[model samples]
Target: MEYGNPDFVKYAEAYGAFGHRVESAEGLAPLLEHGIKTPGVHVIDCPVDYSENDRILNQAFLRAFGSRRQAMQKVLFKPATGHGPDA
Candidate 1:
């Protein structure tokens, strides 16, 4: 381990789970809902390439659907509404 990262750093890194960062502004909708203020709960927005995402998603589909690429096509690609949860 480096000088900065000691033996305890590993444990800290494991415990410190990163927040579910979203790469899109439109995806901030559901986050504005209830229970958002709970401890350790966070939401962020950024940008990512859909094509690369598609490739990675395809692999995920393969795992989910036995290597079937069609599994990825049946996905809903849409942003979210920033309305409150009760809305």
Candidate 2:
């Protein structure tokens, strides 16, 4: 699951890091189990689809802030005007 970027497995291997390259969600459990059961450091290279991630994040954002007028009354979050109470 190496973020679909340049392979970094060599670095891990050089340091004796043990892990798995998970291309999908299904590979998570087994890799996690192996890491927990075995000793020493482990790593999981999980790549993600940027486009799909963007879409999902956008949808979640809309759902959370859909009712702007109502939400604004209770909380000081305003994405539209970008003005809110000091943190």
Best by TM-score: 2
How well does candidate 2 score on lDDT at residue 75?
61
List, residue by residue over 1-87, the lDDT tens digit for candidate 2.
556466655567778887467888988898889889999888778877687886786576568878646556546653455457652
Q: After superposition, how far is residue 17 of candidate 1 from its true place, in Å?
A: 35
lDDT of each: 0.53, 0.72
Report the alpha-carbon TM-score of model 2 versus the true structure.
0.55
Best by lDDT: 2
Clashing residue pairs found in predicted model 1: 23-46
Mind giving the per-residue lDDT tens digits that candidate 1 earns over 1-87? 546323342343467733444446766665545326556634342444567887887678888867464554445534456878855
Clashing pairs in 2: 1-21, 1-22, 1-45, 1-46, 1-47, 3-47
